[model samples]
Target: MTTQPPPRASRPALAPRRAVGSRRALASRPALLALVVLLAAGLFGTAPASASGPASAASAPARAAASDVVAQAPGPLVWADEFNGPAGTLPDPARWNQEVNGSGGGNNELQYYTGSTDNAALDGSGNLVITARQGNPRGYQCWYGTCQYTSARMTTAQSFTQAYGRFEARIKLPRGRGMWPAFWMLGNNLGQVGWPASGEIDIMENVGHEPGRVHGSLHGPGYSGGSAVTGSYTLPNGQAFADGFHTFAVDWTPTSITWLVDGVAYQTRTPADTRGNPWVFDHPFFLILNLAVGGNWPGPPDGGTAFPQSMVVDYVRVHAPGSSGGATGAVTGLNGVCLDVAAAQNANGTPIQVYGCNGTAAQVWTVAADGTLRALGKCMDVANNSTADGAPIHLWDCNGYLSQQWRFTAGRDLVNVAADKCLDIPSANTAPGTRLQIWTCTGAAHQKWSPPAG
Candidate 1:
């Protein structure tokens, strides 16, 4: 396979986003496949908004069915990839970034993951191949045995990030004991706080033994593995996901994340899921592709398992809420204003840092007239009615909280009813070195903020 040059990075253009439009028809419910170890933590609401309305609604739209009737939905390609060509070449670094470490090897899985070329390669014949080979010293040791395996983990971590949208991958799995393959996403802010806090979305995960079933899950502090908010599905009679390529996906919005396989809905969740820990899925998360050998979920490779197995990926595509060419945006708290760190990638519990308005896209944000603060396609809200000078602005599981509520008055000033204050970065200093802090309602220059025009 030939290595392709990463696409030239450029400032994305600002274009109109195509709305999902009126209600979506529900798809027949698929059986839950992922095991959800829902923590004893309190139960939260479904989603923030009606699938047909603003981001602050009380309930999310029901899962859509392929044949179910729907409103006039505008359809044009948002993003897609068709795996084609030879093997041994690397994926476009611009489009796909590999994770270098195991990050404590989440899932307790045994495979050592190197975002390296050896484990992940493109086969010349229309597929991105990920191979799990045994007896590699640089690989991880299994929790079940002495088996050593090398695998690849690829993601769009540093390059492209998406918020509310549809994410899908076409692929076939390798059948054998202890093999784990997944197409998932993690909040881009993970480096700041860490797992369960940054949030995780697993669109599909399959083990060797579960040939006919695929799993979908959402992980956060309060709800995660052993305590994860998960579900699964089994294909129609005698059909195995490992038998061939099938579309696995999730429709994400500011309010909820919906799971599907071959157009069948399995489970859905909203921000309120974070009532105790807050469902942290409502933000910019990068996509991940990996093939692991053994872990907590799939168990370990036994005597019957095979080595040198391969997971084939046909392609991956990301679809956002708006029209093509439109820029999707998010406001990351870098300045001291939010107590968020500089390039730290904050997760669920990271302290909100305060910094100056460097006018960085990470800090630039827009709020729709409908009250949805559309940054990375997720809503940004004040945490717990905090009007204190050090109030923390967090990305909560979108529950129509008055605390999550805000209004952009006269098109610029961000006024918060819960806090009775406007979004103002203290000590209005635009220098890259200044810290952005929040203060009481002063209606002064420090409180004035003009969002960059799209």
Candidate 2:
């Protein structure tokens, strides 16, 4: 699929990408311990990618076992589309860019991708239904066999791309021979640096031929194509992924990439885990989704395979750190109490104060992708939406108001974006009932906060 010639020396060599080769990697390396802890949305910096680095070997591959799985919650919601739109509607054009072609998807796939609602649309029940149907409804011909199927493929290329955090989606996969559904990512520099050099993360790939297992992989310079770093997790309960909706996610950071199925972390790949290839995941990357029919990995569809197979998407979201990387979770101070909403109430002016940490929803805080510190799906706001200093903190409904945006400073302060003030503990008071207030940032010890561990 390298359709373009290497770019001129002055330009990045970005172009089309296809599977590297036909060899499958079954190499073994140290397996990652289950990441049982949840990722906290702290404002932290991610590792930067090197524009030019020497390639490395593929001697060690990432690995994980079923017994090692652990459910790890990704931090606060960043960007999401619940597909909660009117039935038969196309996905949010603001978030998705659909592909329209039958060029075989570089894998000899037999599906003609169309922008028609018949192939991809929303179900009234809060889900994105991508269906693969039999016959050439569009009368698309192929280079080889008659085009026998049609499906939809889409990407977030025009919407968003972040360095790292948690990227996740809940999907009910399709099954039967030849059905290849994937949730993956491609580096944003794809138009500049091309594939392999830009990097790719396969969060989840399930071919109908293997209904019981899903794969997680990384593709780059030396690890592209047949030699990609790959690992998998099999459902322990003797169930197929197509049987129901399940979450597929990745806790991605500057140096490591951990894959999870339904919150259970199974594969963890780090720079050292690359076995020698240059690490290309340090840059921003966009997401892609498609139910490819008849690809190299799963072969072609057969009589036993069913048409009209679908991949139902519940949601797709991205969670990044606030700014200080304070790590996502309750922000605690003296007496080990956490910043909390009083009585689990949800109101426009519900007072927020320091409370003894009890692990209740009220005490749980998250630095969401939008920079809002949230508790119980509501945002930490300035009382009455005021921007004045001394305006007390409150729990309020999220309305995308500037008052809800917060910043975690390296100085351990939570600064409100609207007023440009710090979340202050009045008079250095260590009392649990002391309400949270906005004050001038003085780098005071009380102004510092701690987020939860990964």
Candidate 3:
């Protein structure tokens, strides 16, 4: 949350969690049910996303029966704030640093932000509640003359920040007039360079005037104030964002930023989108959470506004994306067809065929963090754990067997760890109906593969 009214740069230099994993899903959803049955039958699926691309259906982190993917090894848990403490306690000071001020946040907000419990506290219900009260609660006076409200703003500026990857938070927002709540970031250069130059990323922001929609924007050197690059996302079914908690995230890379709300990606901003503007987002940034009263964007609260409003935060997580160095997508070979499950079938000993790429899910593949190339939650394996050069490959239950663990190297070979042999197409055939088998590592074109383009 910035001090408003500055030329989009009140200390323009801005800001910028962990390994709290999602719980293992039970037999509650039909998709997961498919996973359980398949795993039990020793069958896993293959690329169904189409031949042209990963496909929109397979994007957004692929949550369909995702629990079944079972990360070969879960990515490193960098930092997390689970907010699991009894009610009325402060967030772990070791992880969170609070900002205390009331200078209207440059946005002409009315809250005299406080560091006291009256504003920020964890409810006994596994949530960090950042409450905004209309009147003073702890008798602490406002920084401005007779301010009418008080709130809390928390940050991880001094604790943690990563250059790139995934950052997410699950939050149920507050409602009513004059409320301005946000989860966002500022560049780490704020103290040295200042606003716009330091940059700002609004991961999630909601104004009381727009309860059904949340906006994501970026504030940089030339695009500050009302002119910042911004966009809005409205919940379908006429659902008010304040009705329930939703996950907000941004997958940042050197070239672009993709925003997701509730696991659905709605926007992707690339260098091309702001061609003339300087891209300041390539640096490190910190995180901030705050609920302001009467910010300029939402105008001042009217009589209809509610007091004691709170933003209930469920969890914040940051993950270090696992190795992709190049082994995690489609496994292609001779003739450029993909290594596929015959007819996209999932069964024990389902022959691994070389078929024309249709971008089908069966043609897609993922080399897990643990070096296992899997489809439909099952790994590519050598039949009967055979090591002979002619041994066939098939879709078998993923048992973490050496036969199931395959590794891809720049040498262009898929080496089965259990067999120490490479995947080969018989006599370097280029037919769509051919099946590939294990063969001595030859560094041949038949042993080569290319992953999906970013």
Candidate 4:
């Protein structure tokens, strides 16, 4: 059972939890009164808002205005919150709510969820704590009779749901027998047909028993756990999970959702895997945070499991394309695309085609972290290593071969390693098949290609 920390001067208060996986969604609840007071009192006074852009007065950090909540990686931050205060006071209620009962949720777990302030609360030290405490046995009750345990489930439903964007969270799991902590999302269109049909994205999930590992999984028609598309990573040995917090992320786009832990990506899934099952991930989904006691997946809590155990949520964030709808990074700048056996199937000697960006073995390209592109396990060399115009680009095994390394100048021109010849876009801006030839190094805009953003 969670031992309450010694009480200090009273501070503020927040949300609650649930046992079922599909409890609540939508992360748009209004900030509670205590949270507002703490915020005004500058609990985050100098701390930077969890978001990426300029800090606004309304969303001041509960700590210091200059203190940033966390680090940022790829994509732009659209929304986020660092629970830097105690439990009780959470983000605004207008953004969140608790889901009651099973709305045909993806998981077949049992539990009728309810939203109660008691389930979620803030402890004095800056953590949005969600605790699952054992409740006294009531009866075969529907209306407050016999109850064994209670927890919190929070979500961003009414306000901040999005389709095709990266969503992430930094969290510390409650270490106890039976404790279940999850950061996930469900398709926003659940009011109609509901689960599998609605789609579910599990960005991060951990059972108390196995604290050092986390799983990134997806569930849809024909592919739920036991057979769902899933991947997991274990932390370095001796690194206790309770030691610190880690960031878990999912980059959701029209084509796929790439999963990353810390900054390294480990898994990616595509629509093809579903056999055209209708990718429901292409729509908006509400964010959800919950801590549960027992479930079919982890089975029931073990004897070692303790009650009143709390999970600490640091923050949740989402990023999307910029207003101009422009690309984020350069595509040509990429060394070569990683391709799998399926992607490598091209007529021998046919020029390679640029397919969607996937981390698949086929699509994996080695770009020098310093900025040179390598392709097909070799440097992209100008045909004949020539510096003259109309030089064809060819692939040869590495020999430190001058013909093999061609540097892309500011313009799309590829500068030959052997000579100064540039890889020019013949008749620049032609259709996709236009052959790439070498010419004098001339700075032109047509030679550059930026990878489209998320």
TM-score against native, each model: 0.54, 0.61, 0.61, 0.54
**Separate clash counts for every candidate:** 62, 16, 41, 86
The residue-by-residue lDDT of candidate 4 on 33-149, one tens digit each, is: 234445644764543322112335664322211111111123566787765554466545665666543221223222334555556766656667777766533222322335466
TM-score of structure candidate 1: 0.54
Residue-level lDDT for 315 in candidate 1? 85
State the displacement of the C-alpha of residue 400, model 2, in Å, after optimal TM-score superposition: 42
lDDT of each: 0.55, 0.70, 0.67, 0.52
Where does the lowest 10-residue lDDT sum fall in candidate 1?
A: 12-21
Candidate with better lDDT, 3 vs 4:
3
Pitting candidate 1 against candidate 4, the one with the higher lDDT is: 1
lDDT of 1 by residue, 393-437 (tens): 554344444444453332134555344456655466544434433
lDDT of 2 at 232: 80
Best by lDDT: 2
Q: Is candidate 2 or candidate 4 better by lDDT?
A: 2
Estimate candidate 3's alpha-carbon lDDT, on a 0 to 1 scale.
0.67
lDDT tens per residue, model 3, 1-454? 3423364334422222000011111221223323433553353343232111232333211222212222121135588899998899999888888777766766667888788888899998889999999876455555457778889888887887776666789999999988888888877777787776777778888888778777777777666666566666676556888898888877666766756565434456766656488888888888888888875567788989877799999998876653433344566666678888887878767788888878888887876655567776677877755557898788876655455656543234566654556888988886877877898766678877654432
Estimate the overall C-alpha local distance difference test score of candidate 1. 0.55
Q: Which stretches of candidate 4 lie over 4 Å from their true place?
A: 1-73, 84-87, 100-114, 137-145, 322-454
Q: State how far residue 11 of model 2 sits from its true place (Å).
A: 14
